[model samples]
Target chain A: MAERVRVRSMMPPGHVRTPAYLRGKVGEIERSLGAFPNPEELAYRQKATARPLYRVRFTMAEVWGAEAENPDDTLDAEIFAHWLIPLDD
Target chain B: MPHDHHDHDDFHHDGMSPSGHPYRADNDTPLTYWQVMEIAIRELLIDKGIATASEIAVQIDTMDARSPADGASVVARAWTDPDFKGRLLQDASAAARELGFDIGALRLIAVENTADIHNVVVCTLCSCYPRNLLGLPPDWYKTRAYRSRVVKEPRRVLAEFGLTLPLSTRVRVHDSTADMRYIVLPARPAGTESLSEEQLAALVTRDSMIGTGLPKSPA
Candidate 1:
């Protein structure tokens, strides 16, 4: 089988399952809860079971742009552990 | 070597459950006798020991708990705190946690609505709903017409729902695909300034959170 997809800090930049609206975006990691199976793997029924999941928070204007009324307010989302890679150059 | 059988037997596209009914399709389809038999076969697996009812029930329970009073608490905190509201607008899942709710395994996105812009969520593939936060998706949400037309012709679709935003109000459509889901946090309606959290939660109906209605005066 494929080598276990490493828990890397480098995230791929492109039209990934990660929302088109959220790519190239910066957000804080509110907390890191451990592994859960990646959705792509689960959907396709890949071998690995649980992988990690994280809750990343972003502002409304950050995602929606100037159209946001209360530009000061923010919104956060729970992303799977595998879905995110740490920010490293 | 004669290849072994890989179990494609259980795999199904999102458009239809294994039984061949469009999993979320609202329009009627006349089933042929053969197709009907195939559906019966698929359902029997569900009915028999192949898949337990408890598994489905577990999925339902997970969905229910994800959106329950925890949802109310998230909205309530937003009403009371500016800094937290700022965080919520920045990152919805984190915001949800601020109110002491853990989303667990489910993924969520908070779509914000404003004076000039309104937001709506649809799953073009299937009813990939925020089952946890919004309760069950309304029937119309799963319809083929709503899914196909919402993105291309939003104003017409909104009008069908008895929602006619000002021509000036820009409507943005968020299409949910696969695991990720969208939830709309509508602007608190005017004249609700003094309402208590319980009263405010009452005004914040599922439809309002989904962008089909606005937070309104208590009936």
Candidate 2:
């Protein structure tokens, strides 16, 4: 049987899900929401298993303008494991 | 209350009117032969039981009612209430649901706009959008060029639409991958402090939320 590659998110500076609007920015990892079979796979009827889901927390100024809002406010976005990759700290 | 027009096919008129216009003439744009084929695929899915007409109708109904009223309420509350805003950033779908909107099976993300940064969305692969909240996307939003190039060079693309952000402004591009989608919450424009929620919603244009245009104030 062919080895199945583990699905992961590559949120690099130049990846698809990592929007140009959020490059070189920083945010906190808020939660680990459950994931299901990847939609891209299911769109083609490709059989798959459940994956991982995450919600990345970012400040409005961190993603957009520094003057976006008060330091207290922030934004959270849910993403799949296939759309994220760990950055070297 | 009047029945939602898109709830049933009884109100879903597919044919051109006497003046060659669809019931909703505002979005009546000409489609090429290929676009017709694209729609056929969705119909095929329904026929095959992979999806259902009712499901698609629900999607349509979701679109019909997605006005700026909901978005404006979210933004205004975010500006005034710290906790509500926190929930918005933490989980947009739940936040929206708390405000009485049905996100239904649609996963969402909230993109907050600040003074110097902007966020824009495009479906580089397909027109994957949060149809439940934002309504059907405009034809221009689903174009091949816009899909292919928006992420690569957003500033230039936005400029073509007369959205020229200053050099100081940062632009973020989000590609709609999977069923996950995004909505832009533009910073409240100046000179609208005295407006009501309805008035604020009027200024919340679909284009602005998609990051193609800026929120406008009453002249």
Candidate 3:
């Protein structure tokens, strides 16, 4: 079963794949996309540690609150496991 | 037109000097700052024996040879073959390879656009596109407005592209990253049953595959 997770709101001052808007927001894991070399470290040409990547799905309302044009809409982002915290139902 | 140098000098003598103006910017240099930097980096890399010029040329040729036709053919094949469509939705990279397109190290995912669901792709950090199949991404895909707004307000963004989906349809936006890329397998348009594989491929526009628009109806 896919797990629910929340994006960690870590404001590191370097290259990152997690968009700012998704930080600290709750989302559900849609799928496991296998493991990949950490891109955050790869951007610096350093040896990248492989990390599990997940496809996370967030509702439009969860991301944009009342400003969302459609509450039923959803967004999926490829986020590394290091940036996510498992959420309990 | 012969013997007009003196006449040209006289014409410019009213406000400007006969000699070139000292304040004039040098417009003869064809390379922009970024292009100059790119050349410098390429030369440095070559000098360091990291990559050869021939290798660079081959990479350029490979990128130049790719176009929307590759993606169109894949979509067309999927539309005609149910098993292939299953393979595509299950493993897009391998499915693309069946058509002679290797999507490199990055994983490729194909999201289906159906009557109840619509999918759109974006890359918020950078323009990580499926260039092997779709060629270069359009300029708009790289803009900040698109990278930021598409994930937040996809319905409005699609509407801006003249696609007003039914309110009942759910819009799902996919944000591609360095390790993963996405392409939309748009629903086959109505009245396209009579079209051949090649004709169906012709109907698959790059934007449609990107999920910003739908395929044109058969004429």
Candidate 4:
């Protein structure tokens, strides 16, 4: 079964992979892109630990609300595992 | 006063100032602060013996040698060969290697445009492009407007580029990252079955590969 997830609303001050617009939004995991070094830590020249990266899919409506021209259109973004929360439904 | 006017005459028309130093036009030739930082870092790295200047020059030369033509050839081959398309869709980096493109550590993903779905790629954080296959990205790809708005309004963005898709067609925007890059394999245009691979490649534009526009029909 496909996993449904929501982007965390946390806003930390440094390099981050999650875009601000996507914060607190819901999306589905398309696929696992395997583990990659955490770029957030890498930016500070710190040793980066590998984290699972997943490609998340979101409908235009989910992102832009009623302003979307095509609600059915989808956008995919690669988000690190640490940035996503698995939903209970 | 005559000597001062004579000194002005001594200034070369080819961007040299009256002081006999090379001068860059304020409007046309100033490097951005980021560019200046890049130069400083590169020189510092070389001075520290971390990397040689010649190695940097060779890397730049290799990047300069790549163009849209390389990507066009890949698309053309995919259009003509079903097996090759399968491989390309399954493992883009490997398939690109088969065509002699040495994509570095970053994974390359090939998204196909179909009758029902069209794909577009963007890098919201930074401009992460498939330079190994398509050379440097256009300036517009690195703009703030494009990075912020393309995912939100892909159809409208495509329209601004003179590419209007039917309402029934779905637009999928792929956000690229430092770890992965994406390229769109545009659908083959109609009435080009008789054309050779070389001729078909000529129809593929850089924008089409980027998914902002479509390939031109044969004229």
Ten consecutive residues with minimal summed lDDT in candidate 4 chain B?
B6-15
Docking class of 4: medium
The candidates, ranked best first by DockQ, are 3, 4, 2, 1
Tens digit per residue, CA lDDT, model 2, B1-219? 355545344435656554555665575688888999979998899889998989988867767888656666776666556798789888888888888887677777788889877888887766887777777788888998898666555777888999877767766666665457788888888988787766676777788878898878777
Model 4 Cα lDDT, one tens digit per residue, A1-89: 24999999999998998888888889999878889999999999999999899889999999999999899999899989888989977
Candidate 1 matches the true fold with a TM-score of 0.55
- Candidate 1 per-residue C-alpha lDDT over B89-202 given as tens digits, one digit per residue, 9 for 90 to 100: 767776776566646545676767888878877776678776655567778889989876665466677787778877677676666644567778778778777888777777
| Docking verdict class for candidate 2 | incorrect
Question: In order, what are the TM-scores of chain A for the candidates?
Answer: 0.65, 0.58, 0.95, 0.96
The C-alpha TM-scores of every prediction are: 0.55, 0.63, 0.88, 0.88
Candidate 3: residue pairs that collide: none
Query: Can you write out model 3's per-residue Cα lDDT over A1-89, one digit (the tens) per residue?
Result: 23889899989998988888899999999999889899889989999999999999999999999999898899999899999999886
Name the runs in model 1 displaced over 4 angstroms.
A1-43, A46-89, B1-72
lDDT per residue (tens digit) for residues B1-219 in model 3: 654778665646654555655345558878999999999999999999999999999998888888888999999999999999999999998999988896566478999999899999999888989997788999999999998889888888999999998889999999896588898999999988889999999999999989999987888
* Range of the 10 consecutive residues with the lowest summed lDDT in candidate 1 chain B: B1-10
Q: Rank the candidates by lDDT, best first.
A: 4, 3, 2, 1
Q: Pick the candidate with the highest lDDT.
A: 4
**CA shift at B15, candidate 2, in angstroms?**
22
Better of 3 and 4 by lDDT: 4
